[model samples]
Target: MTFWALLILTALLIAAFLGYAMFRGRKNREPAAAYDLRVYREQLAGVDRDLARGVVSEADAERVRTEISRRILAADAQMQAQTDQDGPPLWANVVAISVVAAVLVGGGFWMYRQMGAAGLPDQPLELRKEMAEALRADRPSQAQVEADLPAAPQPQLDESYAALLEQLRETVSARPDDLQGHILLAQHEANAGNFRAAYAAQQRVIELSGDAAPADAYSHLAEMMILSANGYVSPEAEEALKQALQRDPRHGPANYYLGQMMVQVGRPDIGYRIWIDALRVAPPGAPWVEAIYAQLDDLAFRAGVFNPPNIPAPSGPSREDIDAAAALTPEERQEMIQGMVNQLSDRLATEGGPVEDWAQLIAALGVLGEGQRAIDIMKEAVDIFAGDTEALELLDAAAFQAGIAQ
Candidate 1:
């Protein structure tokens, strides 16, 4: 009420000031012709005084008086002609002032209504952090969120593939202890958008592997859970992520999901930092890398970073190296390739390259029949790109060629 009263008083005072200025201007305004007429009349009176004091002859006084009277008549005529043209009419001036006042007051109110938070009080940083914490603490559980979600759309599958999938499912159900069968079932179920079944199969895979289950198994389970819940990270998924990180602390999927969970829980600062770290090591074309790149700016803004630093693209072999290798003889080419691979290895050890370079090196080592060396590099690459589905696929292909992956 007090604010409203003050606003109204301020507006009225402004309008009154403008009105007074206009009225005073009109009242004080004297036409140029009218001022000239007044000056001419004063000069005529001076001439009469001069004649009475004998300071001028009669003829001179009469001539001066005639000339002054002629000037006064012309000035009077010009003033009469300018009377209506001097300024806008009183009513028009009033309307103009009223419109300006109305726009000043009413437009300001309209603009405020559109952009201002009328009822909300200003929140300090500490208070905002406290509120965010409270919101995080009171957020809905996984089950609750899943219950509210609509059914997922089923993916279209060819009849042949569907029949094969059904057979695989039946075989896995009957065998129960077949680790390979469960892995296949999990992969195919996830491909078919049957996340619930996918996660169940993945859980069985983990159970069968027991303490030997790799970080990927747990991460895959968490991924399925998240997909089933439409991207919501449940306590169940978080536990899986924790298990994955325990086995391989740099697991990509686990870190990505962890960052997502942080953002969902009103901790964008933590989320942004986690994502930035992940992106630094992520291979080019990795699914998580692309996803993070797409949303990084928005995430940074929410994290209160107005200008986030750019993430450099991963470097690979130069065209000159490729052209030089291509020009070599067969035996020389092998030697050149080995030299290039050695250089790449040394460079990666000193300053890491993109996942593509890592993949290429692994493939090149396998081609050179360096099985053990390839296997060792594959292990290190796996740890670096853990949980990143696409990057893992590339590394797995290179490992397979090297006879290191089954």
Candidate 2:
């Protein structure tokens, strides 16, 4: 109503201005004959005055007076003829002003209505951000967006698994305090895609373990929720993640999931750091390392990470260096250490060695203050061992001692 009122007011103001201009024009548009008559009268009086002042000869003044008299007669005849006819009615101006006002006001609103969303409240910035994040997550991982893996396939329940699962559920219910039984039931429930059941059983696992409960229970519960929703990170899943991190800040799955969550929630820098840490500590051949390797660099680029330090690969000190270091002179030790470092690095680069050798190189680099080189070695080792848990642990210890991150 207010919008309409403003438009109406604007239209009226414009119409009133136009109408005044039109009326003034009409008033000023006097017959041309009247103007000519006034000019002739002024000229006739001027002729008399000029003659008296001796500015003009009497014969010349007389000739001017005769010509001026002819013009005056013609003007008088024109004015008499004009007065006999009528001019346009006053209503014609009012009609024109009304049409102009209506057209301008109605056209303006019509065009606006055609082009704009009428009466929709604006979305808040936070809500807009959430929407954008959701859209981004739905897109491909590394290819375009954050959700890297294809939606995990929903687990199908086979007849044998289903029968066993039902029997396990009955046993768990009967022996509520049996932690192992509850754990087994929870695992089976998750396998069968019964997420809420899995969630309940995992909760029992946490309850049974009490203060001794590992962070993995909470993290696993979160994973169940996410899988249930086809990778949607809901409030319940987030709460579970919080519990996991609270119990163990560096829990492998917890860190990986939380880091991915950070990426999902538009904190890619935090996400990148989290995933990188997880990748460093994760056992060789872990799934999270692959996901991180495949996706994190792309995420870092998007986050605009400044000065992103050139962290080196993982390598460590060899046993030979350890055995010889105490006996050799400082200069001899330095040369021997350099020789071993060069050999290890060349072998790792050209013909990748065992996990222990990679760890040795990484640790050696760390001791030499080649932190960047150690980090780079670790990055390469993740792929070489990809999922070897034992090798990954060795590299992790070597990286830890060499002060890899520092």
Candidate 3:
């Protein structure tokens, strides 16, 4: 129904309900003077009975009888005056009631209307979905997503580094199917400022890893592409980043570039958010740490973002933990991971955290090969962030990492 029609109907209904109550009250009401006189007469009869039973002194009885008689005479006189004057005037009562009814009904409707949509038509779920889809359609296309990251820092390539790169390349060429060989070649090439070579090796690594490849493979590919192009996030590079995210949403290299992509697309808030999350969860000695911070510091300065001179850095796997884990067997590693996951899961279940935190925990479980635990955590995360698109996207990334989703 239209707003005005509904409002009017509600007001009328309230008015009718109140009017009926008023009418019922009037129908059941007795004449006030008659009722009062009857009550007084009963009191006088009680006093007479008390005096006959000698329950009162004669003097007290006389005084009580006199007071009662006086009150009865006054009531009888008032009743006579009321009869001669006719009944009470009703228009005053009606006018008072009408004003009260109008104030109550109108004021109530006005207050209720203030809290609601008021004049807007109610939108059904289907229409809202269409509108959201249209909005997404208007956003930048896949090709337009750019990283716009700063150029990778370069230092003079020492002779030893050059020799090492050539040696790594020869070793990789000799064993084309060796995944670790390709990965090492890609890393050394990128370190020696041969991003093109790095890109080629990263591609080979992905090829060797095949369909079962994790996000790191694609992430490395994306990074090399950007570095090769002097840090321009091209369409191909963006696609590589997409694939990396498809497998692991919070993959360090991929997220770092993608967040820069958001910045390039004029979404500083998203970039800042993702970068902050990456910074928070990054390993203590991870190579991407400085680069991520460099862009963030610049972005914060440009935007006048107020931050402390030194924000305390996030803690991650300590050296001791790694050393201890390295000493343990694979089965022992599984047990440790399960213990950590249990603690994290219990904490998150009792005291919830942000979307990315949940994603990180799920990713950790997936890395540990705890498929069931990862799935359970994913379900809980989805329930916690239900209907939140950004939250759901983060969760989907975690799920993919966990193999809970394709």
Task: Report the alpha-carbon TM-score of model 3 versus the true structure.
Answer: 0.37
Ranking by lDDT: 1, 2, 3
Clashing pairs in 1: 252-386
Q: In model 2, where do residues sit more than 4 Å from their true spots?
A: 1-155, 306-406
In model 2, the worst 10-residue window by lDDT is 139-148
Q: Which is the leading candidate under lDDT?
A: 1
- List lDDT for all candidates, in order: 0.82, 0.74, 0.73
What would you estimate as the lDDT of candidate 2? 0.74
Write model 3 residue lDDT over 270-369, tens digit each, in one string: 6777777777767554557767765777777544577724544545566698799999998998888888878878889999888877987888886676
lDDT, candidate 3, equals 0.73
lDDT-better candidate, 1 vs 3: 1
Error of 1 at 260 (Å): 2.0
lDDT per residue (tens digit) for residues 308-374 in model 2: 6554433333458567688899899888878879987997799877786787788788778687888
* Of 1 and 2, the candidate ranking higher by lDDT: 1
After the best TM-score superposition of candidate 2, give how far the Cα of residue 196 lies from its true spot, in angstroms.
Answer: 2.7
Model 2 compared with the native: what TM-score? 0.40
Off by over 4 Å in 1: 1-116, 313-406
Give the clash total for candidate 3: 0
